[model samples]
Target: MDRFVLTDAQWAKMEPHCLGKPTDPGRSGANNRLFLEAVLWIVRTGSPWRDLPATFGNWSTAFRRFRDWREADVFKRIFDALTEEPDMEYAMVDATIVKVHRHGQGAKGGLRARPLAVPKAA
Candidate 1:
């Protein structure tokens, strides 16, 4: 399989947070690192679940696993475990709060169907 960029240190940090571990009650995941890489591929590429490559295993299974993890707060724990204190040095503006420049504005009136004027017979 192609290298997924997840280093050993990173995987170490994330390992405990994942489900289907051998120590856990039910079936252990086939390969957690591979599954994570598959998930990362989907997230990075913003592709639909159905488009997941065969190398990742069944797309439906991966998606179902993803959904289960999401509901279980597994991802949230992983983020909390991996992230350090947020950097406040840079100020960020909300996109909704920004005003559009005049040149960037759309047509003066909002889009709507205007009644067609009937030509009068001369």
Candidate 2:
């Protein structure tokens, strides 16, 4: 798929957790992977639903599907499945070494005071 976000392996992990599979009794979701990509696009760009591009399908339909998934907690299950094993290799943070400039720590006189003020000419 063009402009794809989830790799094949990642989609494999999440596919089983998604609803409306062809094997199921109810209506099968049309292109679940594409729907997921649409949702991801919205999140990645932080854009409003109306701004969703035409490539991902109708924005309203995708939004409704997102709401349904949210209500079913499908996203949580997907997240849990993908994060079963915590990868800490790149998650480490060194908080021991830190530096703060003097201006950052409520400098003398504070920032509320105006540094320059000029009288208006009549």
Candidate 3:
């Protein structure tokens, strides 16, 4: 019933498409709704997860879940589903293309532990 959290309609939109394993049951009725709220908090405030308010679940738990969702491809599916239907015949690119700096490759090591958001078809 809280407007700050996802409403039933939003949950329904997500429920049908998300096939990943649900969060494990801990204390009875621990539905991990806070997990979702934590993610929403991150977007709403754009704060580091460690700075997430204690009213939400542990920051590490929320972040681990966020990273897990990234690894599982769940976040991409949600993004693709929530986006307005693509223009089949028309595409838009707003950015100027530029060659990568020589230091760009230095960032490769940090990426080894996380899945990058690379386009599948590219």
Clash pairs (backbone) in predicted model 1: none
Q: 1-122 in candidate 1: lDDT tens per residue? A: 85776999989999988888755553236577888898899999999999999998899888888888889899899999888555666567777779888767887766789888989889
TM-scores, each model vs. reference: 0.65, 0.71, 0.53
Q: Count clashing residue pairs in model 2.
A: 0
Question: For residues 52-99, what per-residue lDDT tens digits would candidate 3 score against the true structure?
Answer: 988876788667767877787876777677665665664544446455
The lDDT of each candidate is 0.83, 0.86, 0.66
Top-lDDT structure, candidate number: 2
Better of 2 and 3 by lDDT: 2
Question: Candidate 1 vs candidate 3: which has greater TM-score?
Answer: 1
Ranking by TM-score: 2, 1, 3
lDDT of 2 by residue, 47-119 (tens): 9999999998888888988999999999999999999998888776675555577777775777576667878
Rank by lDDT (best first): 2, 1, 3
TM for candidate 2 is 0.71
Indicate whether candidate 2 or candidate 3 has the larger TM-score.
Answer: 2
In candidate 2, which residue ranges exceed 4 Å CA deviation?
A: 23-28, 93-122
On TM-score, the leading prediction is 2
Which candidate, 1 or 2, would have the higher lDDT against the true structure? 2
